[model samples]
Target: MAGSIATAGVVCAVGIAAAALVGIGAAAAESQRAAGIADAAALAAADTLAGFAAGDPCSRAGEIAAAQAGSVTACDIDGLIATVTIETRFGAIPVTAIARAGPPL
Candidate 1:
């Protein structure tokens, strides 16, 4: 009976470790998604600011972020450069990402 209990305890620990790994992987994927959205939003804003696209820079950034199920919490434009910060949810936690796009430097 003692050996059986030990085996069960080991199995439970392994199962818990697997679950934690899966949760971590999911959070990482969500973070990557947010980063990608931030990049795209920044690029859109930069393109608009550079006159390669027609629209207000921050407005363009908001549109791009919204399409990807994110919200642009902040946007800043400097000359032809654009920086964008976006927020999205990862499970119950809030995930935020920032990106800057502009002429090659």
Candidate 2:
């Protein structure tokens, strides 16, 4: 009986470790998605900053982020460059990503 209990405990521990790994993998995937959204938003906003698009740069970034099911937390434009931060959620976990877009020097 005692040996059986020990075996059950080991199995429980392994199960918990597997669950943790799965959670970590999910968080990583969410992080990647957030990054992609931020990159696209930054590029869109940079176009506005460069006078290739109309409307405010930050507003354009927010629109792009919204289309990707994310929210733009911040946006900054310097000259023709644009930097954007975006936020996304996976379950109760919140993931944030920042990206900058600019013309090649």
Candidate 3:
């Protein structure tokens, strides 16, 4: 009976560890997704800001981020450079990432 209890305890611990690892992996994936979205949005905005694309730069950033299942939290344009911050979610947690795009200085 004691051995059976110890086996059950070990199983429980292992299960908990597996769940934690899965959660961590999911968070990492969400982070990466947010980063990609921010980068893409920033690039799109920069293109607009640089006159390579039409429409407002920040609006373009919002559209790009929205298409990727993210929201643009902020966008700023400095000359030909564009900066974008985006937010995405993993479960109940919010993941945010920022990126800047422009020609070489």
Top of the candidates by lDDT: 1
Give the C-alpha miss distance for residue 81 in model 3, angstroms. 0.7
Q: Point out the higher-scoring one by lDDT: 2 or 3.
A: 2
Q: Rank the candidates by TM-score, best first.
A: 1, 3, 2
Best by TM-score: 1
Per-residue lDDT of 67 in model 2: 98
Candidate 2 C-alpha error for residue 55, in Å: 2.8
Q: Which candidate do you rate higher for TM-score, 2 or 3?
A: 3
The TM-scores, one per candidate, come to: 0.96, 0.87, 0.95
Q: Write the per-residue lDDT of candidate 2 for residues 51-96, one digit (tens) a residue.
A: 8999999999999999999999999888899999999999877889
Query: By TM-score, is 1 or 3 better?
Result: 1
Model 3 lowest lDDT segment of ten: 74-83
Query: Model 1, 26: alpha-carbon shift in Å?
Result: 0.8
| lDDT measured at residue 100 in model 1 versus the true structure, 0 to 100 | 98
What CA root-mean-square deviation does each model show from the true structure? 0.8, 1.6, 0.9
TM-score of 3: 0.95
Q: What is the lDDT of candidate 2?
A: 0.94
lDDT per model, in order?
0.96, 0.94, 0.94
